[model samples]
Target: MLAVALAAQFMALLDAFIVNVAAPTIQSELHASGAGLQLVIAGYTITYAVLLITGARLGDRLGHRRVYLFGLAVFTVASLACGLARGTGELIAFRLLQGAGSAVLIPQVLSLIQRNFAGEARVKALGAYSAVLATGAAAGQVLGGVLVSADLLGTGWRPVFLVNVPVGVVLLALAFRVLPRDDAAALAAGRARGLDLPGLVLLGAAVSLFTVPLVLGQQEGWPLWSWLSLAAAVLFFTLFCAYESRLARRGGAPLIAPRLLRSPGMGLAVFRVAAVMAVNAGFLFVVTLHVQGGLGYSALRAGLTFAPSAVVFGAVGLTWRRWPQPLQRALIPGGFALAAVATAAVGLLLRDGGDGGLWLYAALVGVGAGLSLGFGPTLTRALATVRAEDAADASGLLATVTQLGQLTGVACFGALFLHRLESAGAPGAYSSSDALLVCAYALASVAALGAVSGLVRLRR
Candidate 1:
């Protein structure tokens, strides 16, 4: 059962990142526009974020097993569709479907783990889960590179999507046999939602309004609509907060309960997580592009470059809890500072189309080692202070926030990188290096902010 759950998770997280290594190939083959490529990436993340809470609610009311199977079916079929897609529009649409399926199913893994495992067994299950997830995310880049470079049957980048079909099918069979049956009460509740639908819509609207412009503004020459859209994003977000607050006051289970945000240190902790995730996703996107798109590195080589970062990150994340209490506490701030330095070093090393040498690999390792502390530990630290019951809600909210942060990073930094290429007159090996260099520095600044935020939280 644990293996089945982790396999599903591995597939889901793999798709989240596998596209990075294949992006240049996809663009060149499909004749995809800059905005189109951004959509290809951000669309998945946006839909996943918007529907995650609702997905969790569905499992509570409808049965985890039932919803999990349904979601797997949707995801499997969508993966096939994505592989068969002939154009940018088709691929982007399929990607959204894939993300929806993922959202519906992913929350159930944790629910199932909690339901099925207990005591020491549960602890071990969760550890394995975390390790597999960390491995999956890093492995995606390497795997995608291999598949694309292999050009099996001359299919180019399509293999990345198609690879999921068989795995999903096998998982579906195993899950049906091994997944525990849901309680009678869960089924009786049916499709009913305790969801905050209005809040969901408002949040979705705000993100879409904001992200659409970022991805497309340069492609469309920055029309008046872009500015109007960004303005609308701010307004919608304000309305969302007000609505959540009102619901909380009335004792409703508001999406992202306002009281949670109001808790001491909670908001800052959330911001620190968001900043780290934004930098993480943004760094991967731009650097992959810089290497493969601009510097003519093969997809395999490009993906392999991230090996150090991935290995160090997973190792650190798994073992961080073993450190002494004081050292663990200090690690968060220190991790952020290390990440900031490493990120800036990357920028400096790669500024003129030169791949940062062995030192560059060292910087990448530093990035992975540092950000790993800022993520899982930050969550554990924040939750240590929260009441037990609210832990689930806080976890769901943080999950959604991380997805939003990823989408935001890809849309904004990707747009800037694309625009830089356009203004410089056609991308070349060295011409677009500065674009990535600039974005790297910006990410470093965000890392520095996380460091400062962690320090302030420590003082408080």
Candidate 2:
């Protein structure tokens, strides 16, 4: 059961960044502009982030097993559609569908683990889950490069999507055979509670309004419409919050329970996760562009460049349990600090027109170590104060925040990278150096903020 759950998660997370290494290829082959490529990446993340909470609610209301199967089927079909897409527009549309399917699939993995495992067993299951997430992300980069370079049957980047079909089919079959049936009583209770349709709509609208402008603004040369969209995002988000609070006060089940947000550490957790993930997502997206797009490295070489970081990330994650509590708590700020230094070093290396050498690899290792160490620990701390009954809600909200962070990172950094390229007048090793430097400094500032927050919370 753990193996099956991890496999499903692996696939979902893999799709998140697998396209990074392939972005250049897709653009060249499909004649996709920078904005089109950004959509190809951001569209999936946006949909996935927006729908995650709703998907988790559906799992609770329907049944984990049932919802998981449905999501898997949708994901499988979407993968096929993505592979078959003949143009950038078609690919972006299919990727959105794929992201929706993933939102459904991911929450169930955690639900199943909580339902099926107990005590130490549950702890181990969660650890394994985290490992899969880290590994899958790294593997996506490597696997994407291999598929694109292989061009199996002269298919180029199509195989990256096509490959999921068989794996999803096998996982679906295994799930049916191995996963336990739904709890009839829980299903009944969930059915009795109505879905918060209004909350869902408002939340989705707010997220789309905020993210769409980030993606489209620079591409359209920052027209008046983009500023209007940004303003609309604020309005929609304010309205969504007011509506959710009203619903919760009325004893209704809000899309995000107000109580969850009120918990100690919850607000800080959300901020930290958003900041860290933004840097993580932005770093990967920009580095891929710099190495493959600017430096003219092959897909395989670019993918392999990430190997050191990935390995270090996995190692740090696996051994994290052995660290002291203070060390564990400090990991968030410490990790971010290391990542900031690494990013700065990489920017310098690129600006100097030097090939990223041993130092570059070391810096990547720092990034992986910091992010991996910080991620799970921060999540655990964030949910520590929530009641048992609200655990599911807390988990869902946290996951949603994580995805939003990724979306922000991708959209913002992608736009910045493209704009830099245009102003620099050509793609070269140092053309995007200023963008990278800005991101690195921003990360450093965020790390300091995390440290201050941690200290303040302790003093309180």
Candidate 3:
């Protein structure tokens, strides 16, 4: 069961960074524009983020193992679809399918762990999970490069997605044999409680309206419809909250309980998660582009460059549980500060055109990212007290926000830097110091925000 969960998590993490190394190749091969490439990556992320809550509920309604297997099967097929895709359009469609599978799979793993484990055992297990997660994320960038550069069977960048099939099949087989059956009586009783259909619709609509427009607007040049969608997003989300509160009053299931949202610590944790994810995702996206395009490094080199950070992050994650309470509180903010410093250094390095020990600076960025990302599991365990019944919902909401944060980081930060670059007459290609500097400052600001959030929690 653990193996299956790990495999699913690994696949998702792999997808996140692997695409970064493959982006240039994907663009050149498909004759894709910048927006097209962004979609290939962000489209999957967006869809994955939007459906996270719904997917978790599916696991709750049906058996978790059932949902897990279904997700793996769907993901495997989607991987093949992505591998075989001959155009940007086809690839994007396949990636969306793949994202859906991930949404289903991810919630179940945490849900299972939360359901099964308690006390010190749960904490230890979570620590291990977080370390693996951090390692997988770092490894993805490197592995993507290796596979792409190797051109295994002349598949080029396709092997990154293609490689999941064999692994998925193995997991599927193991899952069938090893996964425990759900308590049928419990499932039935739970099902008697109504699912929040209205809440689901409103939430989905809200996410789609908010995300699609911002992502597309930048590429499509901020049309009137984009503005309209943003407006609709605000309206829908407001309605969703109202409907959910009413449902709670009526003695029914709301997607996420309003009571949970009222927990100050949990609320702060959610915001912190969002901030960290945004910074992490945005940093990876920009840095990957900078290293490969700006610094003239090969795909393989670019991936390998992140290795040090992966190691540190993995190591830190393992020891995080042992840290004292004050230190644990400080880890997140400290990580953010480190990242900010690293980003600033990288910006300076780029300004100097990769001269004056830029590689050293790049390595620092990796260290900071690793340190920051390593604490995610511990933080999660801290928040919400790892309750059994609420596990799926909590994990799903966290995952959703995390993905959304990543998307937001890219959309908001990338858009800002790109705009600044354009206005400054910076070259359209990725090598400009102007863009790098802008991204650096943006990351720095995010770091400050993370630190502030962390401190607020500590004071309270």
Q: What is the C-alpha lDDT of each candidate?
A: 0.78, 0.77, 0.75
How many backbone overlaps does candidate 3 show?
A: 0
User: Which parts of model 3 are misplaced by more than 4 Å?
Assistant: 27-38, 87-89, 132-137, 324-326, 355-378, 384-386, 426-431, 457-460
Off by over 4 Å in 1: 27-42, 86-89, 110-138, 177-193, 262-265, 384-392, 416-431, 457-460
Model 1 lDDT per residue over 119-209, tens place = 5565556555545544555678889999999999999999999999999999999999999998775456433326678987897788778
Q: Is candidate 1 or candidate 3 better by TM-score?
A: 3
List, residue by residue over 313-409, the lDDT tens digit for candidate 2.
7777667767887676677767766666776776776664467678788888887877775665666555446664454566577677777777677
TM-scores, each model vs. reference: 0.86, 0.91, 0.91
Give the per-residue Cα lDDT of candidate 2 at 278: 76
Q: Tell me, by lDDT, which candidate is best.
A: 1
Give one digit per residue, the lDDT tens place, for model 3 in 25-132: 899899998888979977777777778889888888887889989988998899989999999999999999988888888888877777766777777667667666
Q: Model 2 off-target regions past 4 Å?
A: 27-39, 86-89, 134-136, 384-388, 418-427, 458-460
RMSD each, Å: 3.4, 2.6, 2.8
Winner of 1 and 2 under TM-score:
2
